[model samples]
Target: MPQQNMGDFTLYFLAFDHGQNYQAMSPEERNKERFTREGVLELTHNHGTESDPSFAGYASGNSDPGRGFGHIAITVDNVEESCARFESLGVKFKKRPQDGRMRDIAFILDPDGYWIEIVPNKLKL
Candidate 1:
């Protein structure tokens, strides 16, 4: 698995594409298709070196949004800019930054309908 060093924390992102036609596509095609999907580019971080490349697996099985699991949170450098970029990419939003009382954050849905909360790098009380 590839690793990303973020200050004191090390994070790893393991992505799995379970599209209905995933098994029909070649590895290279799968890689190319992954980037063409909405919200993928924004969610993916730096792929590790060749020795330990980022793992992107494909499966024919479908993925239903998990129950009892809350949304995943991502901290970005700028909330407004990030939201704008996400919107431009046609990512579905559960809650826009200015939609509710909590105007500082936003919620976006992944291809699998999983909610992802976007926050600022620094939280202001």
Candidate 2:
């Protein structure tokens, strides 16, 4: 369990690997036919696919730092309000919204220097 009593807090979405038994794949195995974004989206939804406009990458260390697969998407009730609070607290986001999909996206580093993406979900149409 996470330690109780917090000064500041943040939560992000986690996508689970469906247990294809990655250990079975030897280091020598190459990805000649890895799943594409559309193929992944068509099958299920969770991890950032190649086609997701809102996808953002983080730099987590690995033997091959580029090989780690995971991203955390924080949910915000009101993104603008959250931004104002963050600004007041002097936490400048490393990245800000650019496209329509990122209408309310922001980023801040965790205590361990991990990039956590703050994402505000769109209101249902």
Candidate 3:
């Protein structure tokens, strides 16, 4: 049997308060395929092709009007620097930058109370 091409589909939409959510979500200079500007944020994963089930990417919005557990993550060149920048802009973080079991990380809540995980880009792979 020929291998089936099972591409990754849109799994879920996250929520954030600021418009820079896309920048925070993408960071690392990746291309953003689309931006609805009407509460829709789309992203693409560098790995895992559309033919791979493990290939995953998602969209984010400004509202979390649904009852479900969901969150978004982004890898930064420096967690502290990123946190500082966001903080200077009056953004709130749920958990300050600290040492995690696997990596140094932090958490910030969106307008809908979803946790946004920020970690070092070195720990992404």
Candidate 4:
């Protein structure tokens, strides 16, 4: 897609060790296990024409785990339309486009089971 970025990345570590200890540890503990000076990095992308650029939301982390991290989101022009189009193409949705506690949103899972939140461009939190 013309608006898609091919160089975004999200990072995650295995918070569980088999079935022995399957609990989310504190940030400190998690970092100590494999912490870098930069624990987390959030990236912002601008969309729309240069005259009226809109926030496209955060990009994925530099890396992510199979079943650990939550998701990254993108603001679309229309949630319902986007969901319908993607669904027609066989995209798996973790959540359908509908009302949420804070806003209207939907979730689609990637092949790796990572959720990609889709929200309207005018959505408010």
Top lDDT hit: 1
Clashes of each: 0, 0, 1, 7
Model 2 scores worst on lDDT over the 10 consecutive residues at 36-45
* Cα TM-score per model: 0.47, 0.40, 0.43, 0.42
Q: For residues 1-125, write the lDDT of model 1, one tens digit per residue.
A: 23345654455434434443655777667657665664342333333533355655322122534434556788788889999999899999989999989998999988767778999878533
Q: How far does residue 112 in candidate 1 sit from its true spot (Å)?
A: 1.2
For residues 3-78, write the lDDT of model 4, one tens digit per residue: 2243443344422233433236554554454433322333324334234556443334425544445677777888
lDDT of 3 by residue, 7-79 (tens): 6533333333344544445423222423333334443333346467765434334245354446668878898
**What's the lDDT for residue 31 in model 4?**
49
Better of 2 and 3 by TM-score: 3
- Please report the candidate that would top TM-score against the real structure: 1
Better of 1 and 4 by TM-score: 1
Model 2 error, position 109 (Å): 1.7
Clashing pairs in 4: 9-61, 9-62, 10-61, 10-62, 10-63, 10-64, 11-63
**lDDT at 12, model 4:** 41
**Which residue runs does candidate 1 get wrong by more than 4 Å?**
1-67, 123-125
Model 3, runs deviating above 4 Å = 1-67, 99-103, 123-125
Of the pair 2 and 4, which is ahead by TM-score? 4
Ranked by TM-score, the better of candidates 1 and 2 is 1
Model 1 residue-pair collision total: 0
